[model samples]
Target chain A: MARKSKHSRPDEAFEPYEEHAGVPMPVNWVAIALTIWGTAMLYDTGESVQESLQDRAEDSDVVAQSVPDEGTLLFGANCATCHQPDGRGLRDAVPPLAGSEIVAAGPDIVSRILLRGIDGPLTVVGQDFDGHMPSFDSALNDAEIAELASYVTTRWADTTEATAQTSEEVASLRAEIGDRGSFGGGAELAMMISSLPDQPPMPARSHVQAGDQAARDLVFAGRDQVWSCASCHGDLGQGDESTPRLAGLPGAYIVKQLQNFREGTRENESMQLVVQGLSDPEMTALGAYYTDLRVPSTARPVLSGDLKRGEQLALQGDWSIGVPACFTCHGPSGFGVAPNFPGLSAQHAPYLAAQLANWVGGQRHNDALGLMAQISEALSTQDRRAVADYLASLPPVPAGGASMARMETQDDQ
Target chain B: MNRYLPLSILALAILAFATLMLVIAPGMQINSRPAPEGLTPYSEAEQRGRETYVSLGCLYCHSQQPRSGDQAPDGERGWGRASVAADYTYDQPHQLGTMRTGPDLLNVGARLPSEGWHLTHLYQPRAIFDWSIMPAYPYLFDEKPQAGPGDVVVALPAEYAPQDGVVVATQQALDLTAYLQSLDRTYEVPADGLRDHGYGTPDGPEPTPSEEER
Candidate 1:
């Protein structure tokens, strides 16, 4: 071994030659120490980064191991708010997905309804709902809608009859609808949806039971202090643009509001003045009479707002700002929930906007459990106007007077 | 000279990490917290008023945050509950201040529900309280010979009233007052909204004396 070069590896002891031979020994030691220090610093400070990287690795590992939970995730994001996670719709407002004849009918019916949405009265499982079901034509893609449809059908439909929806079916349905609006009503839907079972008629609940004749008389003829109900609320109690229509409202809701007005729990100068002279009997009679009256929607979109944006707010809320969809609580088409959430459909746009403003400004404090106040506060002015206009554009609940009366007569037996 | 490259890299890495730890990490944590229930967004008028509040630097004299019971007697001071992170969800560039020159206004709306009182106080602090150290914001109002339609007349005391005209609140004053009125956080705070200071539990202190007296 004649004069081994400094750069060469040692063969005798299996030791490697120093790479940084030109640098000082202390500097070399310092560099080694620094390398350890910097690595320790990175390890200490990069905990979050390390966690995220590991999480990504784990995610990939899981992806390789099993099918993705895309259906469950999509259903949670899209349908869970209204249809509920368990697939039971809210208290007869939204139709239950579980055991639904429509869902069981197969992919065509569900896909069509999901694509175009429904704008008129719908009867599900003997319960009547009049509201707008927003069209997913623009919001969701064919594959996503298919995933949602399949998820709901399988999750809620009878296990033996559960059918899965494919993207091809959704795509075909989308092509056929060709940008048509929501199915107008049950009749129009019946025309489109084949194999859909005949829906049972909704059970009649008496909204206007016979009451004090004296109070009924007071409704038509005003006393010396109070104006007649027809003067502001219309002859048929069909509300105008500002004053709320009393007709078709739930009797209990009307009575509660009247009591709130009387007790000053709810704030309204005109309502306060009107309720001062009315006795309890008169309020009940008026509520009952209004509940009996049925009228067509007279609401027109008067306020200038982005109808598309408004429709989105009414159907799909912006959860980023904590605003929920109007139909979630107001009934499917803003037809109003029975007791607390009043009908927003066909109410004047300006009036709706004003009420929202009142809620935001702390002027109106009678909202159920402060939910409306908090929701109103979250809505921007433009959003408020948009939702109000969209609600105004929705059709009113179909008149069920004749059938309901017949049902009520039967119930009397 | 030869060590410059590695030395610079090490220095840069340290600096970058310091920035991430001190600034980015805290910012992400704050931004991720969901807004507490009952903490609503400001209305248009309230938002405008909040801008006014910021422009006026109301934070200089009045603090919106109250210290915890262990830190001070803020609860006994009738300033309501100790301040929490979720309370400021809608507040951009939070108004938490260190000064106690004036009372904390976190629950001012609940304390002062009268808009007229606020208008009068804004026009001249002495109008309501002769000894109040708060500076008057007279510029927020205008003296008009007669109240115009939609112009809110400030109900000033006879001495504070303009000699020959009525004091009317300008839109800015109304907006600022609306903002102040929207400061009511008296709604029951959710359990998650409380800060665990390593203590057992953070129950909201007794109802403020002012609320009880009212």
Candidate 2:
């Protein structure tokens, strides 16, 4: 045989391919790869198929079709500006993200760093780094942040493998901290995050169904032909950037605000005109109409602020600046407490911004004890923007959304 | 030796690998997260308004969710904190749009709380924002010969409003407005920890220390 003699074991043919002496079947790799590329291309794409393929080739890894990890992308887009793409932050200029103790500490500090920004001095990976790391409260949403946190915690926090931080965990941690330092979201404006009890807001028992037939009738049809709440507050008493909504408001609360407008306690030219000759019954009916109508969510912000900052201002007040938490008086969730504070949750940002500016400018002095003015004056324009945007972004607790009723019930308290 | 057996086994293995990497692996990462606390579903009016918003193709110009400040200056833009998944628990169809032709309206309700302003703006974007690129929604309103007792008159500039009549909001306008107004989400989710996030940074204007110290 040709495969003979000189070979030590001539009798042993090339095992499986005995007939061919080990020459294996060649695969048409180029053809197989083209088929995959064609198959993927055949699936729908955005621009023209050709254009999409071209763009995809440039932006994506042809070998791996999945979108890049959110954290890696976020880190590249955000942290890389200073930290360097390799995550070995510029020595002395910025701290490294990879193998950093802060990242190793998990998502809390990492998230906090992202939300509030690091000012003064921060020690990462045992080296003291000091510089202004801008706050991201207004920029990234909680989920995006969570993804970034997970990515960093797992990918860069350490050289060893680690589990990613869940959006829930990042969210909860964000709730507990970020933007709490100054006039912010719902917690103590003056309290530091570390001092917080780590307790979630006390759960309300039940949401009061503020629906009233009289109110609905008054809202849809003009009360005594003088006014229809729907006229100003679009169909369900959903107000815009200029007006306060009456829908889903506590009946008594709406009545009080109306009374405030009428008595010049709340100085509003349009509202004053609307409430000019409204009688008690008409007001009550109107209040009922809006109260019964569900408050729609409206959080379009004309001027952007730090959502994290806004959240901080709304939850915790910058007691350092004498601003109280919005929730202290407005309810733990900014859902209006009966008879006093109106629901700031789901309110319009421009409206809130206007009111805050009015308070700052001393143009509108209707809140009792000049509370609104005092707080407004204390807030810087930036603070106003933050709180307004934050308050505007909140989802109002529905009338029957909760499991139990709050301590202060309408008319009961 | 059935040649089909190895091929079938290979296909099964490929399917298993795909499921493991694409489905199981990623699912294991995000599925553990619980819905954020204090997140409520959209109300009937809000839902109707959301439908209106979708029908109007508002998503074409505006994005509901905000990206990180690192990605964009949206934080300084006051679009609200980066939106989380919990923010869309009730969002049957998630609106994670990325168009910024206009400003982010994720919290527009809180930003501008006026029905009249919104109505007027809808009727003519130029009325409130002179430089607004948004087209007018004249179809959303009815040109009534006279302003009825309870009819809302859109305070449109003479250029937009009919010279002989007032603009009355139609049902579609109302539905859309309701949805627009209900977009506030300022409440701190349980994940944000204890304090809210609305104050100026320590680097900004120095906050005067208050009397009551915690």
Candidate 3:
């Protein structure tokens, strides 16, 4: 054995073994290769781990693979700009789709909105967006309309549990409304559409039996409780001075208001306290019950007023003051848009006057209403009264009364 | 010789790494400095108030940045102008919060000119807003004890009640208020013709058609 000297040079020592080890083998080379390979493997493993963790965190289990495609195309073409692609809508102008009562309301109301258009004062997501939405009657076919309605109901509005509209239903509505111009406003449409022979009675609260019973029980048990839901809101769910009437409101609107109260966003002390104690289920039931209640046409009786003066102010605003015609947005009647605008007809005069005053006084500060305020401020005191009185005296438009052409023209502008 | 060779290589490697880091890493951002008008160096009292605002977690319920659409008439309602990134350049950690339990406070300082009104409103919101559901911040204020028989106390106006002689406004609140009041952006940029037109700045000729057209 040629024993290697202890102090032999590294090159000399390894030279003899190079052939056996294969490739100019040195002790450090093996170590370096192993280290590099190990690092590469570790990096690959890290990337895989990160990918897996991300996938897990995303919890793709809950998300639907693809949102329903039925109404998606139509909604995108017509509704998405204001309502948003996801149906969440801008904070105020358009109501949310995830849980709106209007979406949950029977197909008639939904179809009527599509046939006519909505306008005037309305609140969505606790903020008010008072803008006009054009009707889609001329733009979409009956099948397309039905598909879009179904999509909005099921996918965006989360009323998947609610009955989907059939193409036949859409056809019938189109036929019935043929050549008849758009309905006047939401109120007019609601009244007319509800009276239709094909229209179903308001969705029974019984459908949500568990929720309705629980809410009824809570409300009934707390009947004598001061400031209970029924105290300011009448037993029939009609609203009083301290509160807006809840009956006959689209279910989606009711739920949004309740959520606003609970979250302290609505900013009414009494409502906050009243809603603070309610569980989510209780709120849902209360909303459903109120939405199902019949809206008695007890809108305050039209008071005798200077009708001619009021009509003039409403139709032709005093442009010198920069006041736009009320009819430009509020509609011939004051029914407003279904989901966006509020019904002004038959509303208490005091409330209407107070709101107009609030707008001018800067107490009410909505972006959409801001211009209206400026316009209101320009009006003489008598002008304000005439408009308000005229608004209050007008009857709510019958359902499906708005014209597709009117809606289209409004939307284009 | 061997030791010397290894040491030299290691030193060179370390120097090269250091140089690389210095060249590649981001440098401190100094441009777009916030205007310091109306802002005072932090005082101990103001600092305490700031700490109080933080502890109360007011940011969770309010946003300082107003949306672009909000700039129209909404700004006149006291929400203020849309916030620019430069507005928060000085913040160590920006508090661009989300939530609107109350109105945005970006321009609240200018909106509420009356200090007394703020004090009274904070003590009891319903006193100011009959329908307000906002929680009262009585803890931020000192309640006057019922006047003792011999104590000669001057009745303050219904609105004016200082939290303490040294009013312990949360330093967070004071700083936040200071920050809010500092949001006056009334300087309208002049159109092209109005730009450097012999008013003072040196760089431009007298009014020309192109400048006037602008």
Off by over 4 Å in 1: A1-212, A398-413, B1-214
What is the full ranking by DockQ, best candidate first? 2, 3, 1
Candidate 2's error at A404, in angstroms? 6.1
lDDT of 3 by residue, A1-413 (tens): 24576664556546554334555567679989999999999999999999998886565533434444546756754566446787776453345656555666655567767765554333333444343454556445678778777777666454436657777899898888775544333434346434322222232234533446767765444421112455335565544221354553444445666676666544444455456567777777776665545333233311222445555666666677787766556543344443434445444433455456656776455425467678767765445545655654543332322222235346557
Worst 10 residues of 1 chain A by lDDT: A400-409
User: Model 1 compared with the native: what TM-score?
Assistant: 0.37
Predicted model with the maximum TM-score: 2
The TM-score of chain B in candidate 3 is: 0.53
* Candidate with maximal lDDT: 1
Tell me the spans in candidate 2 whose CA falls farther than 4 Å from its real position: A1-214, A223-227, A400-413, B1-214
* Per-residue accuracy of model 2 over B91-161 as CA lDDT, tens digit each: 76866678889988887775455566678779887655556799898999999999788776666555665
The model with the greater TM-score, 1 or 3, is 1
Candidate 1 lDDT score at position B133: 86
Ranking by TM-score: 2, 1, 3
What C-alpha lDDT, on a 0 to 100 scale, does residue A6 get in candidate 2?
Answer: 70
10 residues in a row with least lDDT, candidate 3 chain A: A196-205
DockQ of model 1, rounded to 2 decimals: 0.02
Candidate 2 lDDT over A1-413, as tens digits, reads 75566756635555555354543334567767889988877674534777877876666554344656657767765556446778787665456878765566666656766665543334455554433344556557888777877777777755354546667776777687744531221122113344222222323323324445665565656432134566657776666655665555676777887788888766654456557657788777665556545443644544455565776677668899998888777754566666566777677775687777777666577678988888888887777767876776655434421111233332134
Per-chain TM-score of chain A in candidate 2 equals 0.48
Supply DockQ values for each candidate: 0.02, 0.05, 0.03
Encode model 1's per-residue lDDT on A122-238: one tens digit a residue: 666666655346566654688988988887777766657657778998988888888676676565666655645553333333433443567566666655334456655666676
